[model samples]
Target: MQKPYLEISHVNKTFQRGSMLTDVLRDISLTVQKGEYISLIGHSGCGKSTLLNIVAGLTPVTSGAVTLENSHVERPGPDRAVVFQNHSLLPWLTVYENVKLAVDKVWARESASVRKDRIMRALEMVQIAHAMDKRPGEISGGMKQRVGIARALSMEPKILLLDEPFGALDALTRAHLQDQVMQIHHALKNTVIMITHDVDEAVLLSDRVVMLTNGPAATIGEILKVDLPFPRRRLELVTQPSYIKAREAVLKFLYERNKFVEAA
Candidate 1:
């Protein structure tokens, strides 16, 4: 069997909050093929975001391991790029500078022209080139988020991690950004793992949807393969049985089976 490009092996994470130890994730293992899109969906406390953070090397696992392309992931590096739920832009910087900062760091050895090209391409990819001169405060929420994505992409990481990126947006804005993300993934084929609570968003974007059981110690409960064909249209999918079936499977797992667990 071909080895997966990204591997999470028997991972567990625990935190010492005050006097007590809290188990956040337990024995979580997953394999992601290159260029595939995977979505993690569960109730609020399921540790889905925690798992994504571990993969991004933003957080360390307490036990077990995570690897990408056979290299062990120990800390945050250019190989993995993350876009958090909040835009997290440096308020003092313009969109161009925000993305340029990443490109400069990753391609430090390269010439200035090459770095400029990388920044421009990333901004264009997210359709934010027009707002390149605008600071974070000057743009709308959706546009700021797009700049965040562009900054992440400017690094040309092997995998992209999105942590509920559109969660704060209105329904219409969320839907539009979801479509933008799908198109970007379709074009770039970057391996992705996203944490989301939206069932429709998961089904519409992922090649596979990974469902997690509730927390204190969350683990993978079910994995649903989205068998629908690509170049997927939102209008057409609403009426497609395969799409509906996939969407319902995720909803069932979230609502009927694995209910939310209150935090400790």
Candidate 2:
């Protein structure tokens, strides 16, 4: 059998504040194939982002481990790039500059021309090259998110980690960006691990939707395979029985099985 491309081996995470200990994740194990698109879906506090963070090496695990391409993931490296919901751009820099900052960090030793190409290519990949001269504050929210994605793509990371990257956008813009991302995935065929609360988005984008049970001990509750062939279109999927099946599976897990209630 082939070795897994990305492996999360029985991982666990905990938080310590004063004398209190909270377990956020327990015995969470997953394996992702290279170039596959995956979405982590669960209700709030279910540790979806926490698990993504562990794979990104942004947070340390309490036990078990993560490995990429058979290599231990001990820290954040160029091979793993992250794009968060906030867009996290430097307000002081142009869109081009924001992406350039990341290219410079990962390819500092490369020739100036090579680094410049990477920045341009990445910005072009997200169709935001025209706004390369604009500052984050000067661009619309959707454009800012585009720049954030471009910055992540600049590193040519083995896996792109997205933490609710479109959660802040309006519905129209969200749908538009989702289309572009689908194009990007088809073009790049790069591995993506995204955290999203939107079931439609997951069913539309993912090869598999991994659902987690409710926290503070969130573990994989179910994995739904999206059998619909891709180059997927949103409107077309709406009436697809396969798409409907996948969407209902996710909804059932999130609403009926793992329904969330507020803490008093």
Candidate 3:
């Protein structure tokens, strides 16, 4: 049998502070196929971001393992790129420069022309090429977020990790960016794992939505497969039976079983 593209086996995470050991994730195991879009949905304390961090190799897993292409993931590398809720663009850099920084770091051995192409390609992918010369402070929140995504994609990472990338935006802006991200994923076929609390967003964007139980030691509660076809339309999905079923499944998991608590 062929091995999974990304294998997360029996993973657990814990934190130590002032002699106190707090268990975060417990024996979580997941298999991600190539080009799949996975969403992690759960209550505030359920460690969705923590799991994403572990997968990104930004945080250590206390036990078990995460492997990509049969190789163990032990540290942060170019293979996995992350986009956070807050755009992490450098204050001194323009949108172009922000993406260029990542390309330079990851593809340092390439020629200057190659790096520039990489930067421009990513900016254009996110539809931020028009604002490439603008600084983050000079743009709207949505544009800044697009730059953050462009920087992450410029590295040509094998997997994209998004942690609430649109959470800070207004409803309309959030919807627009969600469409952009979905379209990008459809085109690039990049493997993605996003952390989101929105049931509608999860069903809208994911191939499978993995729900987490309430924490101090959270584990996967359910995995709802969204069998909807590609190029999903948000307005049409509202009345579509398949979309509504998936959304209700997530809602039932989040509220009826998991009892979601909003983080302060």
TM-score for all predictions? 0.96, 0.97, 0.97
Off by over 4 Å in 1: 260-264
The better candidate by TM-score, 1 or 2, is: 2
Local accuracy of candidate 2 as per-residue lDDT tens digits, 1-264:
877899999999999999999999999999999999999988887798889888899999999999999999989899999999888999999999999999999999999999999999999888999989999989999999999999999999999999999999999999999999999999989999999989999889999999999889889999998998879989888999988989988988887887645311
Candidate 3 lDDT by residue in tens digits, 1-264: 766899999999999999999999999999999999999988886799999999899999999999998889999999999999998889899999999889999999999999999999998988999998888889999999999999998888999999999988999999999999999999999999999878889999999999989998999999999999999999988999999899889888877886655532
- The regions of model 2 sitting more than 4 angstroms off are 260-264
lDDT of 1: 0.91
* Global lDDT of model 3: 0.92
Cα lDDT of model 1 by residue, 1-264, tens digit: 989999999999998888999999999999999999999988886698889989988889999999999999999999999999998999999999999989989999999999999999999988999999999999999999999999998988899999989988888878888888899998889999998888888899999999999888989999999998877889999999999899888877876786534311
- In angstroms, give how far residue 33 of model 3 lies from its true place: 0.3
- lDDT per prediction? 0.91, 0.92, 0.92
Looking at model 3, the pairs that clash are: none
Q: List the residue pairs that clash in candidate 2.
A: none
